[model samples]
Target: METMHKGSAGLVSAPSLREQARKVIRGLVITGQMQPDQLYSVPRLAAELGVSATPVREALLDLEREGLLEAERNRGFRVVSLSLNELNDIFAVRLLLEVPSVGDIAQGGLSDRQLDELHQLAEATRQTADTGNLIAFLDTDLKFHVQLIATLGNQYLAKLVETLRDRVRLQGFASGESPRDFLKQSANEHFKLLDYIAKQDRSGAEATIRRHLERSRGVWGSRHNTTQAAKASVLDESS
Candidate 1:
């Protein structure tokens, strides 16, 4: 029997198939459809998606490289479980890097052209959110941050932040809040950060980054905990 799936019809090429499979599996993880600690084999995912196992296997290996999944030898992949404390630790490392970097940028100051570019990125971030293009908005947001860090003229530092940001991107999708609301909040924070940068306020910029990181951690961490608790309660009741 051919397993029918919505994603099976859109394949233009093998690479596209792999990319699509990756996105679908990532969405499953973000939405909690795929539970942590459960092994998901390539064949099972391929059957579910109505696609060949090759693309699904490649996608799982890609995700495993991203730290979101752990491959068991001779077995399948498992989504890595993250706790609130672990989330906090990620934010702490971000703060340690981002705060000083932004502060340095502020003290050094941005040229008018650079400032305008930041302003445009901030506007794009907000508009993308308003228009409900969450993924595009995230990409824009990342560009803005990467540019901000790059202003310090340290390639290694900027690259480190970029890598860390990629690792935490999944958190943006797992907030459990309404998409528009969460996106709007994120856009507002970007604008505020830009405001401090425009004024060349070192202390203000550092403080804003700290507050933003903490608030983001709190919002997503809280929602994640609530969701887990609700799931646990349901299982307990059933048991």
Candidate 2:
């Protein structure tokens, strides 16, 4: 069953469907509406997503293989929790993949139309930031980068980038943590990345992405630390 959200097109049983399903489930997990280690019921997810169980199951299996979920003994599939070390590991892999991929995108020389498309995405991000719509800003920011690399003409490399993005998004980044400054900072990074790509500066693009990912890791670390402290304080009060 295909239902269209306003301003969004219909979903067919195409690659687009897979991507849409992925977005829905990822948003659910990241927003904490679906907790880490909670069991994933395919039928329930399908109903929520307004799709069949097949797509839900397929999407979950794909996410599981990407290390976002684990096999549970009794409770179907359990969402994977990100420990500090695990988060660090994700950043490490991101550096290896995205940093170099950005360099490749710069050196590969995007078409004029592609460059224009990226600029439009940048403007969309800027507008989202100005309006304090951080979620939309992050979505456009991700679209800019993912579309840039995906257009670089490597299917597997694009898939790798998308998978890593799912991991990052599932960390609640889409919700924009800390303060508005953090959102502004991330949006600025995308512009900087676009500037480098526009100038065909491969090294600059690579360096910028590495820095951005490192800063992302730092922000997430701070957010987690704050959350942990708050939880501890609550426990102290309770006990």
Q: lDDT (CA) for every model shown?
A: 0.75, 0.70
**Candidate 2 segments exceeding 4 Å error:** 1-21, 37-62, 71-77, 173-178, 230-239
Per-candidate count of clashing residue pairs (backbone under 3 Å) = 0, 0
Give the candidate number with the greatest lDDT: 1
Instruction: Tell me, by TM-score, which candidate is best.
Output: 1
**C-alpha displacement of 29 in model 2, angstroms?**
1.7
TM-score of 1: 0.77
Candidate 2 residue lDDT tens string, 1-239: 12212222223566666677766665555544455535767665666666777777777777778877776654466666677777778778888888878998888778889889988987887777777654466678778778877876887877777677767645453233425676677778788988898888999999888888888788777756665676789999999
RMSD of 2: 5.1
Q: Write the per-residue lDDT of candidate 1 for residues 1-239, one digit (tens) a residue.
A: 22323442334455478888887776565444565646887777787877888898988998888777788887788877777777777778999999999998888889999889988998889998898765567668778889889988899888788766655544435423447877788889888888888888999989988887777677667766776797899999999
